[model samples]
Target: MYFEKIDSLNDLKKLSIEQLKILADEMREVLLLKLSSHGGHIGPNLGTVELIIAMHYVFNSPIDQFVFDVSHQSYVHKMLTGRKQSFLEARHYDDVSGFTNPDESEHDLFCIGHTSTSISLACGLMKARDLRQEKNNIVAVIGDGSLSGGEAYEGMNNVVEVGTNMIVIVNDNEMSIAENHGGIYQNLKLLRDSKGKAECNFFEALGFEYFYIENGHDMNELVTTLKKVKDVEHPVVVHVHTIKGKGFKFAEENKEMYHAGPPFDRKSGKYIYPLDNPESYPAVTAAFLMEQIKKNPKVAVLNSGTPGGFGMNAEWRKEAGSQYIDVGIAEEHAVAMASGMAKNGVVPVLNVYSTFLQRAYDQLSQDLCINENPAVILVYLASVYGMNDKTHVGIFDIVMLGNMPNIVYLAPTCVEEHFAMLKWAMTQREHPVAIRVPAKEFISSGKEDTTDYNKLNKFAVTRHGRDVAIIALGDFYTIGRDVADKLKAECNMDVTLINPKFISGLDTALLDSLKKDHKLVVTLEDGVLEGGFGQKIASYYGTSDMKVKNYGIKNSFPDRYNVEELLIENGITVEKIAEDMEKIIG
Candidate 1:
């Protein structure tokens, strides 16, 4: 009722503190009402309502930059930034992205979904503004869960060292997709419980001006604290304490469930989809790893701050004991730490998403790949496009990981291959392996795997077709299969389908065995086209007499469109492939 009259941020900013508190309540109700139908990160957004309002009211957005780490909390930002109506009726519509998108609104400085990137991006924006001689302040709103990320630490360390004029708001609601892990949680708890007094001084240790506030939900305190921090001359970290799922009883009870989700019953707090057959990578992977760690005492599991997000459960912690170490969200430390753990005789398995893996690229290349540490990096949602508008498109890992020496890239199209690769990767003692597990369903078969992947550079051919060769990478194999089936059934053309399980070291044997009669070779991957697996294929066929076309995501993407449409637009079409093959043969 309050927000109905309040259409703009200006109207919101004009409200009194009492009115602002009530506005937060109204916004929470509105969000729960809308998202119950569409499903979203209601708990995180609900908890952030007041803080987002305070940020908008105090800081001039679209001019003064605001970056939300993981960006799930941006739902309140979206409401205040004038995308509320789109959120209500047409939620899944292209206009209202789930994450922050600079293109969507200047209010959303960055479109990011992954964790631990706010500080780095914010620091970059600040530096860019300085180079251009711009005067606007750059603010990064990161959560305690995000602060666990090594990139955030590196970014904060860099920002502090350089002594820039910026505001880093630490939204310490004490959760990151799931209950956070590592020493930071203990430190955050200590500081959060501090009533208007400072404790631990974590950021202060990093050469940052630190200010800790007790209650982030209190609009007066939030605004007042922010105003005080904004007056400071150097880069500072403002630690604000807030509740996760502050209002909703169910969300408060189950903070993890409400982290980010689809629509649910507001009163019941139960999800629209019953907890049966949930589509999750972490749970599946963690469940399987528990089985492995039980069998092999030497096998261990690692996570950044996302132990819970990556599906590390209490049973594993209880059973595996110290074998399961959540390295916080510090991906760089997690990777290097896993390498060290392996050097000491433990087979460490690091479960991380492909996008977040970018933060530890240098460590992955220099520390593990160079020395050939035999650690297993299980990458979920690899080569991803727009799952959410957040800064988490993991489309670059395939291109990046494949080129790294002494590292094997395994793209498992289904669950059997997924678990199979996981098992194989854990036992290896020579080279580091990164498995690309796409967010598609698992194709499970009861068949046991007795195969040894000593030579990981191999491709699996699903079908034997003569006209055209469709080289599919990772989960993109399924999409290519659909295209191949369309070519076979619709146009009666036999299309060869090859799943290059190994992304980096392509099967030169398979490529060498290609027949001249098999006229057209099309490579399909889910990563960026340039410097991606498809381009690698184009490079493979560059000097040869083979005709090649590369298909994947192109250069820059900042919008939500049909995934199938994206493939078609990129020329990985069923009809187009059929027509091209027919022409080539004729």
Candidate 2:
């Protein structure tokens, strides 16, 4: 087998064009096997097999630097670069991360996981190479979906300024995580239709020599074109059009669903572990938004690009109609647009993931918070239970957004509280509001939340006791409750359990009240300890007589960690917390 004969790029270089074609098919089989069992980016990786093969054949990696945007499609690159065992053998599946890691191999230049960063990163490499007078090609592989980002344009605009050797390969599979959006895609479509003869070329306008390949899957064409651009002096863009899920019939038919998913059946493409919960946060939020859209024409829901992640699927998007606006993979624009919409008497709810939301910090502070536009931002996956990838970790949002002024960052423990806070945010006109949607399982109190969210920074005293008070934020409330119960059962101590609804501001009255009876105040938050909710509490009581113990993840970028193990490492387990409290109380 061509694949069996290959161990590294050197081995791959020995194969003939006809043999390389056979190798591509072999690689797809392995990819399907690994992805079906292990789970990862299926379609993105599969579509780029031929392109990555051609790239490796044409450009000498490690010598010729390569940067992959969003790195999810780097699975094949990893396999080619002395890391095939991670995919070939199930026993070694957990050895490598899903995204590109510089530590894993020399071929991967950066540990990139986010979108629209390749061109900018490549520009840095190109600039440094020119400074050193080095004669090696610097290539950036960016997908067409990433063009919607502001940074991509900024990179394109700047890459030409250097006027040096830099190659940008645009993998146009006509998709992001979902289908493509924004105005840039129109140009891409035009270029494709006109067979690269389109007069109004976006890349050409950006001062780059542009080349388009109609069939990116053609290995001979890819190699031939890539050879021409190799070591060329000046910026160049190689636009290649290929099918997203090339080898898989089901994946090609359902591109969005197959972009990235859990383990599925190889033949039928049925998910091995399908989502069983209909009342998930995404579903619940989608239902609530639909109701709001139908009731009020002014109510609009906005997401950057990942509609499925927010539960705004095809059906929901169709139902919401124009009220649902996807700004593509542009989080910064989404925030600013929401602010403008809110200022013009339109109620805009911008739903985004916590990791992606951090990209729009400036817009959140300046456009929304500074103006106090009353724009509602629903932040999903903002807990330890969220994304585990270091680049996509959700633990930093509390610290990032919580510290911002004129923004009420609310954390809800259950569905009831979430709905109440969301409804209040939609109607309120006093300040910009952001709600951290719980990343844990759906919890229902079986009662309506009648608490007036307008009276901001109010702490809900769920269970009252003495000596020890546990103040929990968002998804960690359940853990705090368990700690309290453990203290009660094991140590026979009645511990007070408090749920702080507001993350940004403290309930001063309640804190003062707790100081009177509680000797030790423990803050539980599903985020990093530094600059987070726990630190805020600790800071608040720094000059006071009250003893504060903060529990959260330490400031570190942990990748693909087990949730339970990570919590245990951070001293967040019920037993560990209870044991510590017992000693303090004694």
Candidate 3:
């Protein structure tokens, strides 16, 4: 009744704390109902139900910017902002995106779904407010996982140094998509769990005004905290302790499973249709590699704070215990630490997102690549079609890692091939190997499924034809195959599908061969068009002789995504690619 009656944030101020708590309960029910049916970031939205309410009631929106780090938690904020209907009914394609979008509502300051970006974005907003001489409170609601990022630290340092007027709410649920990783949260946990008597505060050391709220779920406590800090001068970190997946018993119990998920049975709290193929890339790779580490004591799994998501969940963590080192959300530190481990005869497989690896570019180039540390850096979801916000697009990794002197970038088109790439990277002793496991299923390629580390130079051509060379980098390899088959069946055209296993650079011989027979070469990737593996292929073969078409993400900031739509937009659709091939040939 509370939620049905009150549809907007304005109605929030009218309700008492107890009334607001009822609304939170109703909001939680709606989130669970829709997410259990449609599926999305269930735990995150459930956790932030009251926090966003507290935020809206505390700060004036449109004027006072509320920037959320990895804005998936902003669903509650959207609901209170009068966008609940969109989430409940039209969740997939409706106006209300899971993440923050300025276009969706005036309350959303920035369209961010990636972690560790709120502080920097908030600082920018604060600077803009200063220049305009506008009176608006800029509040950044960031997770503890985000604080492990270098960008958050940079922003915090800058804000402190410059004396910017902003409120940085560290929504410390001790959880990211999986259970939260990193030293920052560890320190904060000690601080909160010990009732502020805990020593060695990272925030105070970094010159930030610190206020730790032990109870984040208590609506009254949240309101009091926010009210106390409203429009307060200078930057401050209101480290609020909250439980992720709160209210939902299953979600609360199994934090990792409920982080971000598929449609689940509401009562049973079980996934409706089991992902017949649960992503085996990360887990299998971990299983196979972690086996090697356990066999040989020198091997270690280095996590930049996402080991659980990397398939080394609590069970593995308990099994590996200290062997699977989660270096927190610090990618830079993770990379550097891996390099150090490698230098001392230890094998380190640092699994991180392709996009998040940007933070460790300098370390990768200087520390690991320069010394030729033969570590395995498992780069997951390297392509642009990643459904997360633009800030998390690891699409630029091909170009960024391409120029690295002693690094080999393996773009595995299949899940089995990803393990093969992992095995190969594990064997290399001279230089580091960065394996990119694209978002695609690995069809059974019956060829000796084992890795051939020595033959790292060779590239696999999936199929052969002459009309048009359909080049696919990683996951798009199958997409290319499907398109090529469709073209052959429909248009009386034989198309070649090339799976360039190595996206770092093109196989010159194969590229040169395509020129003579292929009428058109269409390079497809799930990354950015400007600087991607596809564009690299275009540049390599787009000489006057070859008519190469580059299909990828356009030069623009991507909005919140519909996965299928994103692929279609990037020209990754089978029908779309087949149609394009037909038109070009005709």
Winner on lDDT between 1 and 2 is 2
What lDDT score goes with residue 294 in model 2? 99
lDDT of 2 by residue, 417-511 (tens): 99999999999999999999999999999999999988988899999999999999999999999998887887788888999999999998999
> By TM-score, is 1 or 2 better?
2
Clash pairs for candidate 2: none
TM-scores of the candidates in the order shown:
0.89, 0.99, 0.88
Backbone atom clashes (below 3 Å) for every candidate: 14, 0, 4
C-alpha lDDT score of every prediction, in listed order: 0.78, 0.92, 0.77
The candidate that wins on TM-score is: 2
Order of all candidates by lDDT, from best down to worst? 2, 1, 3
Segments in model 1 whose C-alpha atoms lie over 4 Å from true places: 60-65, 88-94, 120-138, 158-165, 196-200, 206-210, 234-236, 274-284, 308-310, 383-390, 445-451, 465-467, 479-495
Quote the lDDT for 123 in model 2: 95
Instruction: Give the candidate number with the greatest lDDT.
Output: 2
Off by over 4 Å in 3: 88-93, 180-182, 197-200, 275-279, 384-394, 449-456, 461-470, 479-497, 513-522, 541-544, 556-586
Candidate 3 per-residue C-alpha lDDT over 1-586 given as tens digits, one digit per residue, 9 for 90 to 100: 7777766667778988888888788889888878877778877778888888898888888677888987878888888787777656744435566677777778877767556888988999888888888777889988877787778888888888767689999888877666566557668878888866666888888877788888888889899989998887788888888888998999999887888887898788889876434446666776776688678777788877666556777777788866788766778889998998998888888888887788788999989889988888888877654545655666677668876777888877666677777776776787788887765554556565554656655556767778688877776677778887787788767778777777665678877777788878888766667876677766776445777788777766565566688776666678877787778778
Error of 1 at 431 (Å): 1.4
